[model samples]
Target chain A: MNQQNILFTNNTAQAIDTAINNIRPNGIFVLTDKNTAVDVWPQVKAESTMMSEATLITINPGDTNKDLKSATLIWENLINGGATRHSAMICLGGGMITDIGGFTASTFKRGIKFINMPTTLLSAVDAAVGGKTGINFNGLKNEIGVFSPASHVIISTRFFNTLQKRELLSGYAEMLKHGLIDSAATFHKLIDSDPLEIDAGHMLELLKASVEIKRRIVNDDPYEQGIRRALNLGHTAGHALESLAMKKGKPVPHGYAVAWGCIIELILSHTHCGFPTNTLRNAAQYIFSHYGTPDINCSDYQDLLEFMHHDKKNISSECINFTMLSNVGRINIDRTATESEIKTALDIFRDLAGA
Target chain B: MNQQNILFTNNTAQAIDTAINNIRPNGIFVLTDKNTAVDVWPQVKAESTMMSEATLITINPGDTNKDLKSATLIWENLINGGATRHSAMICLGGGMITDIGGFTASTFKRGIKFINMPTTLLSAVDAAVGGKTGINFNGLKNEIGVFSPASHVIISTRFFNTLQKRELLSGYAEMLKHGLIDSAATFHKLIDSDPLEIDAGHMLELLKASVEIKRRIVNDDPYEQGIRRALNLGHTAGHALESLAMKKGKPVPHGYAVAWGCIIELILSHTHCGFPTNTLRNAAQYIFSHYGTPDINCSDYQDLLEFMHHDKKNISSECINFTMLSNVGRINIDRTATESEIKTALDIFRDLAGA
Candidate 1:
């Protein structure tokens, strides 16, 4: 917890100003992907002074590059830029950038400090709040990492204006999860919003609500020992789908994959956790109608199942999941759904989404 | 803390049997150096059931070889061998193997369990016991690492029977440090032992004492918050000298560099901490008479000092060191020694050691 203030602002310029004035890091190493450097750095540079102490380093964008090679390149950039143990790194892109940059800062000389200025809607709400940083190794996602918090996380809403509609739709899925896990009020707010019409202020508020829900859960169980597992309500299937997408090079945006997985997990919850059948079906239909559906093929079912078994969340060779109950704002982390039930749920989602 | 029933046995065959029956790791990965694999693997193969596990991965040894490349190779081995998250690795060579192997284990899939069965005397006493594991990157020693305890640590003395005399002497320097810090009995034992006549039993006892001393210090401050800086006693100059040696491709064994650094630090302590002049002079003379003198050129002094200034240990730009007084069992950490006094102490050691 070396970070002083975890601040959120709608203006990127103000966020940068607060970071420079409040943190006054020994030096600033702004980390971004090539796409982000192209799309975001102009806004970042326009807001901040070119101090003698700061240097900028850019990584390539996208999940394919979010592996050990990228982390190594980032480390090299830091060293070549004369970054020391006291230097602070600013991760300024999507989840992939944050994951790689945060881990580089955490491991450089045992550790340094870092800040997250997540641009993607998914990352703004999830990756920025959690201290989880990592790089994939050998086909396994997040196989190498440490759970070290950044000094501060600055969430700015300016980037939302530039986000693709599809990405925003994908990100809203997690907002729904926050409601299903602990807050009916937040859920209703999300349901009431015109996803297409939402402005930066509304987006920031949703981000805050979503982050607050996560922070409370993590505060009680930072290391995922028990209660924090509740946060993974849809992630058991979500990660498997993401892994399959990644391996095939189809590469679904992480949030979209999670949204698809949530539909399946909800159906399974109805069977195993005694969730109301209509409530689960309605939620599944809502998500599928909004985010479209994952292109899961019958031919790839076994491969998906294999990926599920290999999910880091699984224990004792079982495709264990943190399924939910019927009530909105309540979930069960300890529930396990059978393989056949999981297949049935996925099949139902495919039929419901007509995919 | 995860590790239990750690053993430092005297027989290699017995150590393997002990690991098999006692620890019962899910899978076995025997880490060996090129030297050990060529000379000792034949005997090791005849003695242990390494192939009983899913696979065996052979890696070249040495500090240069301990890098991201080797980590990748090990990862490939694990994947090919079907090593699950439960799999554990057993490092069976010197300090370099343990550092790299432990780092690989600690980082793969966030982490897996591993054991240290240090073969070299230098590793048996120092590297094996500490939870610190890392690999050098971009010419920086231990540039990337994590502080996670091994599943178990086994420091069998049987390996030391074949250890080169130089390596044994290097490890003995640490034994002397233990004596100087808190153990009069250990100091007496080290002083009395004839280098040629030393046996495995005596080495095991010394290793045990050193481990206990390190363990206590770590328990008080697991994450190196405060009191743990005392461990940096000889590391300031030692690290610089070692780094210089590594860059030169004629790396000095870690203990050799540290031993020389200790003599310099002791002299500086007298000038800065009101240390008795007679005690400082006598200690330098004793080491010079026993271990001969270290050879360092005047041109390298500035380079060494520059390196020390960048050491991860320094809190600020100012260099801090742990220095000792004539009272053999007492040392003061968090002491600041003047540059002139440090130069004078180095000059004195240079003259005494006939550098």
Candidate 2:
């Protein structure tokens, strides 16, 4: 039912059942957010019989709710329910649920088996392929956490039925990243995709393919010590923009920020890593046409750069770590860009993106 | 310089230099408590040329200060000091220092390389052999933690020159348990030694042998999934006694409580697993001779029982997790004691120990 601990299924509840059978836990705890508990949890239980037996624990929705308070709630529930070393926790919903749930299970009694059932399109590709678990702390995103991966990453396309067109496009940004890092063929596949059509069964195959690229990279470097940083291709600048959006009280989807950031990164790649110019231009064009531009200006540059300085991938305080590329799949990892070059990239971003 | 990641060095600072070389870190952060900063940090720096370059981060002393606030201070210091992923942290002090330091290093940026220099006798024996890193959370001991093993465990006997006789004898309790679980010969070696002197060079050899036994057991079960319960021989009852002592404002040393608990566990072994009565009596006699037993009465039995119920080893709400032995070196792990049997063991403890 599950291959390489990633289950691609039409029935997410059945996938949870498969994970239960795999672990044969003494107890089962299901964690979801308030929104997902109402919209998704009931649907999951309707499809499978055994899933209803799991003790339901819900938190609030969004990244704001994915805090220590939520983690504490989950911990208290597991303790109250008398969870044992042999018990398993099922994290349902999106990346926020999986991230915090994986963290709690990893720490409670010094870790317990956990299965991640990622409901959002973004999480299906992003959170599915890696073992990064954490929660925000001290005004930092995932500032305190560990590399505690899920025992199983169960992705069900059926859950994407609730998503809007913007949500579909958000996930597609990461899929495009998988392509740009993998091969030209995968990149071209996404550029040719219609954003309004993840409902057409084509998205399932695309997601599986996208997950394969990240899975191969994550398998090689589970701790992100070296080559595994390829997954952080666009995340450096994207994260800063995401932070800026949050601070401005106009938050955007994670993939939207990533897509915009990848454009700047592609230019950095062309300048530093000798990435081909036409490919960079074409990629940026695709992003500009599909993804809405963030309200960023030269005034925001200083703050974005400040956020980049705080990136987790950094090796030294003097420089920000950049995962650049020479061409599709020709990764030039551990690269660095000067402050001036970063400004240049931003300038190019402003001109091309018309922001 | 280091064998099996554990360095028995005459110079503690030299061992830290060895760890730095092994990791080739971009930066170094040394974490110590206030007392250690006053005493051990100077000697460590006086012996080494390069150690002064490291950023020294000190926290308040004792388990009371080993909380989230302390962990936050460490994290903030590391962040402000511009620690990178390639940086290494040195935790130099007792169990509390190593515990919180290991935890902060493990979680900060999803873990950084950390070295443990257990300056105290208790820490060298207990913290060195295991990978348990934690901080007290929400009024519970080690409620939030991870099993992040140190990159290096450096031990220097010169640092033991600062310990009181009580501290030296306190550590002897765990060393005695190590001998009991290892073999009859090891147990006899400890019972034959005097408690007045750990500086006579015999304690160093004894400490090495004790650590070897624990090292072997820990290597086999790093995560404590199975086969690691043997190491929990006395901890279950020991921790309860330790808690009771803490609550009464008459705190006993950790090893003293463990020695007392081992006596009760030995009686349970005799009742359940046919442990030799003479061997049990001799072990109990050795404990009663050196380690002072805390005052306990039948009225306090309920509190002690409740404390045991809150032990981390328990798997279900119904029964407590116990690690009993059939004989010397023949462990009967995953065993459970009924509440009545526990009471009976306590009764025997009172009769023999004059509690």
Candidate 3:
């Protein structure tokens, strides 16, 4: 949403150079995960001259490590490294890294400036656009965080090559959701593209489109008060399914879970918000055909409901609140659906997926 | 220095009622310490009708508990209490409660609105006015925090009735610092007033003036970029001494430490910034006569220096940065002092204390 804070550049090195030159920080703290440190840091270091003097703070890669324990570790590292209020942190990696790193920078000395260089498709389009920074606690997603945006967000599609097929697909899922929420034409374009086969240039265009969709929504409502709820259209169901999958020990990638969630929620939209049934059917067919259905059944319905109850969007103790679409680009927030209606929607998804 | 967010009121209950009416929160969570839960909550509850349904969260009283552990416990309480983005937190105690509670409220669900009801003189003039929220980590004072202001801050002199003499004096130290920084007339007025003998009405007038002084500085520079550094005149050496005393098993009251820090820093002001020697001697005589010197001697100098090294204001690794006074009312910030000059300041403090 902070248009001036984000830079879309083909050459990340040049972007980093410009940001560092402008900030003129007293010191630099670079945060990365083991995965990024090995796969991505060399390229980043080679490009930015400042990397030689920066303190490298690495954490183990994965969502499981994105917790308070990791945050405490990062805080201690920043303190021991003598990071001052004038110091700037460079977060280079996926969502987990940026979330934790941004949180660390925001809380350290009552907040220092942070520059985000998102290395994954999910982070580039989603996390980097929003000033949301946090870590999970007590098995809840983003349970603890602050709404502090990075001073600069540098997005480069070259990091896409480092992503596995599943990782790439995970980010593509959000792109689909953005399209579905933004316009019918965008939705069709996303459905028609083979995510795994997209070239760097084309994928960069898609990433920019996805980021722009989020940027507009966030700019209109940075605090998620009203219009920004549209951004959570798939997240209501998607997050529940993701939490359920994680609980079941077969954690699905966020994008895949979101892909599955979109299919189920689209059916809910048709029933609750009078969305066109044809559009719902078309959406389900395309998403399921590409990502396939998550291995969830009627048995997982209660767990999914339980997870949904804890969703930050739901302010009430009863009845799940959802962002339902009357049609593509049309959203109705704070819509409550009954348990049976939700069950029926899952059943529709099961039938569509042939599971 | 969020002028719109703060309310100075004689009727605490009416202010709270108005704040609750305006915010229309989903729920209310009240944070207090064991001391306040017994001594202060009753008065607040009787005044504010909203206290009836609010969830009560309590922690032990003291600076020792103002750490990440306390923050974690408070977060758990908020999460378990079903606090949503719409929920409002009422921080009802001194600095420790507000610091931990404000940090908890600011971070929970990426921030919920928090109201501060400062119950101690120290908090009334200092913590309640500033948007500083934090918890100590790894033996560092306020090492982790955020610059997030409360939705409303309610200050009542009636709460001062519960403070012990030491607590009252602890706050008076800061009030003196405010006077010293604001004007020569204000400084003389503060030194002349007997903190212990002053009536509640007179004390309340002084409190308002102190708060106003801080409000002006913070308003001009909320993030402490320039002029706000003047407010840190005594804090540089005060925080270092406070931390040393805390580490030494005999934690001196904050105001007492600040009073001590003022005397030492005034000497530094004279040496480095050419502050009037006669004014420094008079100020030291008044402060030491009233609050007797702390037992720290030459042996504790190294620990004090070490603690100052970790002070958040320090932008570099070398010289200690201080806010020195050009005169009683004039201040020069970001001045570096050598170890010998610092030792000389301490020696002056000791000799004046008859050590």
Candidate 4:
């Protein structure tokens, strides 16, 4: 009863309508970002009955806007809109909106029912499923947050179809990860297909299966006390690069960074867990071909390593936490690598990816 | 499985040691406030084997320090001290320390294990239990928060015995409330006793029972979706008066406000829920004789009314939420009274208490 429900529908409006009927909240507020307001909010306004009467609140679009000030603004809006425990909020847009929206809803009068409408493929496969809601605090990415899940996650292809090529690849990268760590057939099919050319229906199916991998792990360990660290597969090196890029004003999409991080981690897997060499090389080639390298050089590796040292998964000692796969669906979580080992892996990653 | 365990120990050092043993953390961080740092931290360092090795972190004491700035300082301190997910933080102080400490620990690395050492009686009976961790934000009381419980609540009277009279009365007021709401016998004994003269062991027993009432309610419904609201009893008006006093730079102890608030809410109980008049008047007499008035008049009623409007329990529509009683042990929750009814209650409260 405390966990989130996954609502898979071909149409967004029907999914939203179903969510509303189930929650039966006394009041409802839908949160969005600037991009979704113009592109997606119109669709909800024209095509949905339950959503018509809901108060629509929009914020600036981007990870930069996901901060305490935005959170404060959302809180003020919720209070002004008269949201209460009996009320429910729908977080619409990409990861940015779902993240800030979930955090705001969870803290508004100590949490109200929230339904997440993750419009972007990246969000649907990642942010919307796990309920790891947060906003960047004091120049740190996702520095302040809580582990409170949404009541429902409404996934549909209506908005995902409209995403740009870069964004599509960003999400596809994670799907590859889902494949490598889950179904080998899924990984093979993903590596074979052109992410940019996949039909919306097929992409939606892939997204659904990929997110299920995360949803299951999260359901088993919502607080990340143990096995949930499996979800951090590529995130250690990935977050470091993402943060450095953001600091340099040349931002990289989350899944893109994660994609690159996967190669390095898989190499480590091959070294430490005796993972198949062919499988690691294949995954690395796929990432490099699609996701592109993070704009980094020898100078940036030290900063990247510094960021890795602060990765949330680390134990009380000086070690980099890693989650690698010995094989598909064979997750090895709660593993650590020395800084020297991690550095060596980074060097190999750069040489192989030609970064 | 996610609930907090309670550890009742006569010796404070033994409680801390047992908590450390139970958690078996990779590292330990002990959080304290100005008062506790001087009064209790020394005892912990000198007597406890597990706590002496802990990193001692202190913040300014009192309710005013229970804000976002203080929380930020705690977070920064935690990061600087290299606290990780395997770490455990012992929150050592009154409600201020436990509330902020619980909040910080829960968010740090998406939550590490935290143990609460409620040094003050008010914290032991109220804030330290029920997982209601928060910090005041946006100039609002506990406006930012999450419902994340500590791993264990270690209750001991070593520091409580040294509490100032006002602080002791603050805790006793909630004990009286627990008595009225759940245990009439407990309520009668509390009313009959000279609160200032209660022995440490007797006070610990009363505190233990009072906290249990709250803990049971929280356990039944942690998010206050239903019956958990019963624990809100006098908090509505009480929180308003407390906030107003803090605003005026003449802060009232939380339990004093609750004691006075209990009289008003009980009066409203008589009006709306058919609560006994003899019981209401006797409670009012006890409050007025001991807790004293909130230092307000007819002019301040509007401010009090304004503050009451912001009470967290109210629903979407404009009405003041009241958790009244038909009689002692007969709780009436999820009840809303008209603004006029609340004003009338306030008026009667002034007349009876001579505020």
Candidate 5:
């Protein structure tokens, strides 16, 4: 048993049952967006059988609303409902909902118990269980946030059935990332398994495995002070691409952007970082074959670099990228890559896009 | 020679000199509100010739703005200014500015260096030195915040020369609190000095003592996981009064609210917490006679109790208050008063007011 009485469960109904039976909170605060309030929250309430005092706050969904304004409203609702430090906030939505809800609970009355009941695949497999909570500001994404552990995390596949194929694929990128950085067996299993066909029978097992992998990484470096930066492998270039897309008001979903970012960075490593050319090419081919290519060109190259400057990982005076080696399961983190090097890498992206 | 590289300086000019010589950086980010920006910031800038890159962000000065929206704007400005982790934030103004700015810096990119240059008499002795950073959420005050240390703090007595007499008297209450809680000598000094006649030279010594007292308390228990609850001696009632004031718009300044709260809690402490009646009488008489009581009646008592429900120090379900003893130089904390007892205390306030 884990020292933290914190349980990780995937079945939403079962998870709520466990929470109710174990915690028996005085009241509940269900956090959702307009989307989840209409679709996902009803399922949660029906299953949990919460009391009348249990509050529901419906907010606007997406990264845009994951901000101070939403947090203030949530705080108002929770406090008005007489929510105390002992009170629990059950976040029931996607990554944006989880981020804002978790941040609110973490800071409201200086931290309260929060549970993430993720509805989207992106949240369930990646964001739901993590303790990171943040909101975007000043054209930079997640510029302000905190590291707050949740009381528990409930990952329900019921919401996965509603996920668009693109959303499911977005989440799969992270799972693939887990495999590339740490586990080959996990990678092979993902390759073999049809995520489109993840049945009820296999759901719990899959969730457990993904969560355990994350747990181990977090356990090793909870504060992101060192080895944790490895987990940000595709993110340096990926965040820039996402922000670029966001600025254009046509933001690509995170996973695809990262998928493309990983491809280019791998090519750069093959040439600049002395990785085996064959392995780098093979990895690039596999991603391209699996997910298609990312769109980019020399014209937008400087824009990508500007986005890189906003990355949280670039703590030093200069912007740095967390590059990778050709060896499967190895990473080179905090490598100070020059602007010229990053531009050359973007050239590969441009080539993928036939730019 | 001590591990602490920066000493808390009394002179604003010298402190700026130290900071400039020590941490030479790209630019300075000075945080202030409309009130402070108009008056305090000009003085601060004049004392220290900031580089051309130094920027100013003026916010609406008040506790209500000390929420997520304010933090988000600050984060946006910092990122837009290309403030990296190396760039330092100099918080100029009162507690609200210091708390919000400190929190913004601490959370911006997972933490950055911040220097507190407090302008208000309240912030000068207390808020400017410690690294307590947070914003209020919902109806809760200081609910969403973190405990992080500052890179350095500069105490400038020059700003107090610009303060209204009422504001000076209000701050004098905290100065008295420091003496009552820890040192009889400091208490006597405050008792002897008239707020109207206080000179900058004498105020600086008192400011240094109060800052040192807070520093010792914080160093002993930085996170307030324990002992530091003693520091909250009057805040239980103080925060409620401040909140009530805020709802009405013409807010009773924080120091004034806390001063009244300290007296209310002191009277109640005598009856239930073994506090000496004489000590309570003396303290109350001194504050009430000097400050003239601000209003707290039965109508607003329930709201005050509700505010206490959100107090950060409450470990369990009960809303506890930190009540001190009659002893000249000691404090008792985290004392839970019954509902009836709190009511009785409110009655005492009403009786005193003849309301």
Candidate 6:
């Protein structure tokens, strides 16, 4: 089921053309959000002659819009536009577009072919490789979805030119996490450099490394039954904070919350997994200084815990699960943490913020 | 992906118990309709101690309720019930229950194990063997779905005692179709017998043969890419008629519609595919006499053709696709039918009704 083939190209137009020629779909549908429709679609249109004939479907640009309603809209549009099972869909936007589009394609007519042309850095590196496709349901993130991979994931850094500084920083957080989880040297190098100032050549190299780390884990455990849990090192806490922010109607960007969660989980790793205190302290200092702290505090811990209970990784309702690290690139999955320990870790996170 | 294991038993209770013990899921969810809730669940509860602890979810019985709204309700219930990724769902009812329940389980928390306990003969012989799971969307039958097989499909004949005459006759349509599409001897045997009067032992043997026929086709092409389209021999015209009936609010049961559709298509098969004229005459006479000719006539052909365009099997708008039969157990898929040809076929169908 992990059939996604990755192609990194500087000339995205050539890549898109090549893919379309190979698939020879009966029809082509391009899915985008309002933001990508303006900023990114023109470039895609200019690059491939295929866009002239492809049907375009756009949704509102936000995580809140990535719901069943949006999926229904896409399905209806595809049906109305004469989409056959042999037709192909091109998801050309950020993570929200790719996630919802992949899900729509996976389900529409009982699964059609789709290609992901991830425009934002987060999607290109993180969402592109994994076969996870879904939409948020009942105020829960990714509570409804399937493990269906794309036919192709075409990555090009050209679309980054349209991204804002904040979005770039959000994407950088995942890249930073990949480095920390897989290679201490890469983490050190990433932290030493100003993420916002990276050249295209260097950024592509970083993207390849980050995507490779995720690809290896996902390929080994496509269903997330084992080693793939390691990829959730920061996500257990990250998703909780993200959900709470969304529920409160003051949403935090996903990567920023993840960077913050990594700091808290790093502390947990130090306490339970025999992680070196000095390494944790250094990583914590860099993350806090760069990503800054989220507005959530000790008062939000209970709400966050409520969110954690609904996390897909948890088997029982009693204890929260986390992927804790014994050392960089050496981690243990399904590690349980008590509410008291979570509060203590949050305290350590706060202390590191002040320090 | 074709991993479903079929279990045949007179003692369904013991089978349920064995399956539950083998899966040993963190939680069990039983999905049933109002009818099955009253007729079948008591048997399931008495048979398996697991049901004592399982959460039971019921939906209103009918094809109209098989939609995204119902799927959303099921997902919300599962989430609220503390159903983890390790939870398993038991779809215990007819085609409607199995179809929608399978969709709910397939998408819940990115899928969980689901076992099919098909109560009606239609589901046992047709829907049970196919890994097709879905809910109808936007006024279309099975418009949104996935090809995810169940962990197990448990068949039993005890539930047949509770079915109404019409319901029993409806399920018998598929059993008849399995014969028409795969074996002429089976078709002749079924035509000679009274479906409702068959003893349990004989009925079970017929079901095993029917299920085996469908299983071979599905295993050869689980995704309906090629040979599986043969299973859609009657469905092309059958679905169009069913959708029209549902739209007009004079809904016919699925198997009856398929039985009618099979007669119409058999005529098309004779004219277009060199099928023996006498075989078509005999089969048509049997189907018309047993199922009775639907109220459809020349007036309904336009509306039925309108429905056929959206059949999910067509490649273009110009011509509707049908799986034409060359002979019993021999089919040519993706065959095109023009409006004129369709009208002629309907004319032959009307002539048969009068005859």
Off by over 4 Å in 2: A1-4, B1-4
Indicate the docking level reached by candidate 4.
Answer: medium
Pairs in clash, predicted candidate 2: none
Candidate structures ordered by DockQ, highest first:
3, 6, 2, 4, 1, 5
Q: Candidate 3 on B5-101: residue-level lDDT in tens?
A: 6777778899998888878999999999998999988877876679877999999899999988888899889888988778999999998888988
Q: List the residue pairs that clash in candidate 5.
A: A107-B144, A138-B76, B134-B145
- On a 0 to 100 scale, what is the lDDT of residue A324 in model 2? 91
Candidate 2 on A137-204: residue-level lDDT in tens? 75567877888778898876887878777878888899999999999999998898776654547888
Candidate 1 ranges beyond 4 A from true positions: A1-5, A9-25, A38-52, A183-188, A316-330, A334-344, B1-55, B183-189, B289-295, B315-329, B334-345
Which 10 residues in a row give candidate 2 chain A its minimum summed lDDT? Answer: A1-10
Q: Enumerate residue pairs that collide in model 1.
A: A3-A151, B3-B151
Q: After superposition, how far is residue B167 of candidate 4 from its true place, in Å?
A: 0.7
| lDDT measured at residue B142 in model 2 versus the true structure, 0 to 100 | 77
lDDT of 6 by residue, A1-355 (tens): 7567799988988888888887889999999999899888887797678986799999999999999999999999999898988899999999999999999999998899999999989899887668899999988898999989998999888889888887888888898888878978878888888878999888998888889888988888999999889888888889988999987889988888888888888889989998889888887877777788777777898999888899988888888899989988788888999989988988888888878
Off by over 4 Å in 6: none
Each predicted complex: what DockQ? 0.44, 0.66, 0.87, 0.61, 0.40, 0.87
lDDT of 3 by residue, A1-355 (tens): 2443778887988899889898999999999999899898987897777986799999988888899999999999999899999999999999999999999899999999999999999889887668999999889999899988888899889988878988888899899889989999999898888999999999988888888898888888888889888888788789999898888888888888888888778888888888998888878877777777788888989998888888888888778888889999888888888778888998888898994
Docking category for candidate 3?
A: high
TM-score of chain B of each: 0.90, 0.95, 0.97, 0.97, 0.92, 0.98
Q: Which docking band does candidate 6 fall into?
A: high
lDDT minimum window of 10 residues, candidate 4 chain B: B309-318
**lDDT tens digits by residue: candidate 5, A238-322:** 8898888888888788887777777666666666667666655555665666666655556778898888876877655465657
Interface RMSD of each: 2.3, 1.5, 0.7, 1.8, 2.9, 0.7
Report how far off residue B309 is in candidate 5 (Å): 5.4
What is the Cα-based lDDT of residue B332 in candidate 5?
Answer: 67
Q: Compare candidates 2 and 5 on TM-score and give the better one.
A: 2
Clashing pairs in 4: none
B240-293 per-residue lDDT for model 6 (tens digits): 989999988999999989988988888888888988889888888877877888
